[model samples]
Target: MTGGRLRPGTIFGIGLNYADTIREMGRETPTTPYLFPKLTSSVIGDGEAIVIDTEITSRVDWESELAVVIGETARDVPAAEALGIVRGYTVAQDVSARDLQEADGQWVRGKGLDTFCPLGPEVVPAADVPDPQQLAVRTWLNGERVQEGTTKDMVFTVAELIAYLSSFFTLRPGDVILTGTPSGCGDFRTPRMALKPGDVLVSEVEGIGRLTNPVVAKT
Candidate 1:
């Protein structure tokens, strides 16, 4: 199903969940953690093209992430029981407008742009993924592998993140929590390599399948 078909719910994301990514960004790892929400409008289906708005943003970067979909409502759930509520997992590309993301001092506008959140070829049932923490997640631009890592590198496990989030608000079915991205984002490159029209991005989670999409100019 397309993101538009999703019911109204919070789209949460964790930032800097990978240690290598934190070091590469030249920032100290967070003591408490960082999280953000994406507008539902930002969600797009796999194989769909992301429209690059060159006039407003020229530095667009791609982030591959594993997304957790909540199956049941959870409030103040304990970490040990957090995974029980996970419905499934899916692949997501957190497309970013670097110039706007850094200049705005906040992620809302830069992250909320339409089609900025590309999710799913299909959601793999949680049962299918026996251990989310043991899976490998990677991203490819065109045919070149740009990012490669495993969930084993995550500083915070999915269960821990769910428990932490539940302490703040209730998580209901259809709610999506983007775990985070690894090192090798386009923005972190020496000269910086941004996505251009025609570039294809594919993110894959070991058992969750791959999400593929091409970049297109917004006309």
Candidate 2:
């Protein structure tokens, strides 16, 4: 894909949409989707580097997610018709800084850091993915499987998210919605796992190819 295709106009992140994730955080399943906006500048393609500034945070975490790429302008769309506006699907890594996320009491900065949102490998047309909910989402740290889950567990389906989001704001072509991640994020592990320089993070969504990026310290 070209840089233009990789650079989306807006990036929307859904939080705690998986049952295991909700249980890990000890929070009730949300009735409505939890949303946050990520800076487009943070996005990178496969094989790119996920740079981390040691001074800013040492608790960086990884979230494997399936991203919905918008194909047309959407407004007040119904869930049944939401997929009509989807261009395709891609893999994404929601690299996060847990310290900042908690200290700041918000997710923007923690989730929007430069090189935090890694997407691509390639976009699989929406039609190609017969049921977004049937796919598997996974993550690997330096070749060892760190996270494993399925889209079938998402609290809100892709169609539901698109419909809900468009109801409040217009979703233009190239906009991306990171359809919340599954369980096994580093933060809630028995011993927390954080990204470190030299570590390779492999994020995958079934059907969409794997998006691999190396973690590096900011020089």
Candidate 3:
């Protein structure tokens, strides 16, 4: 199934879950998970355009992330049982408005903008992805690779994140966890290469499918 097939539910996002990414940004590893939320309104199916709102912010960036789809109701689950509730996985692009994100001092508006989360061409069932931590996540902009990393580099594994999240709330069906992105994001690049009009970005996660989105100016 594609993202368009999902039912309305909560979407939790993990931040600073990659040690190398944290180091790349000159931050320390979190003692606890840094969590964020991405609204369901932000999600769009594959092959959609990621509109860059230049009027609101000029520094639009792209992040390739692995999205976990919950299959069962889980409350205070342990890591050993966390993966049992997973329905599948999907590739997602976490588009961001860097300037607005920084100015607002929170990720709600910047990370939850409409069309900011491009998810799924299809969902690969959890059974198909035996080891989520071994998957590779890559981002390409304008036919050139910009970011490449393996889930093994993640500071927190998928099961660990699920267990951690379930400790605080019930994770029901259709809830998605956008596991944090890796390093090589534009935010840390020299000369600051950011998304502009007329750019196509492809977010790929191994074992799942890819999402190709063109960047366009806001209407």
What TM-score number comes out for model 3?
0.96
Tell me the lDDT of model 2 at 4: 24
TM-score of candidate 2 relative to the true fold: 0.98
Candidate 3, 14: how far from true, in Å?
0.6
TM-score of each: 0.96, 0.98, 0.96
The sequence of per-residue lDDT tens digits that candidate 2 reaches over residues 3-29 is 623878899999999999999989899
- Candidate lDDT scores, in order, read 0.88, 0.92, 0.88
lDDT of 2 at 82: 93
Identify the candidate with maximal TM-score.
Answer: 2
RMSD of each: 1.5, 1.0, 1.3
Model with the higher TM-score, candidate 2 or 3: 2
Q: Which 10-residue span in candidate 1 carries the lowest summed lDDT?
A: 1-10
Expressed as tens digits, the lDDT of each residue in 1-219 for candidate 1 is: 555333337899888899999998998888765898888888888778899988989999988889999999879999999999999888888888889989999888888898899888787899999999998889899999999988888889899999999999989899999998889999999989999998999998888989988999999
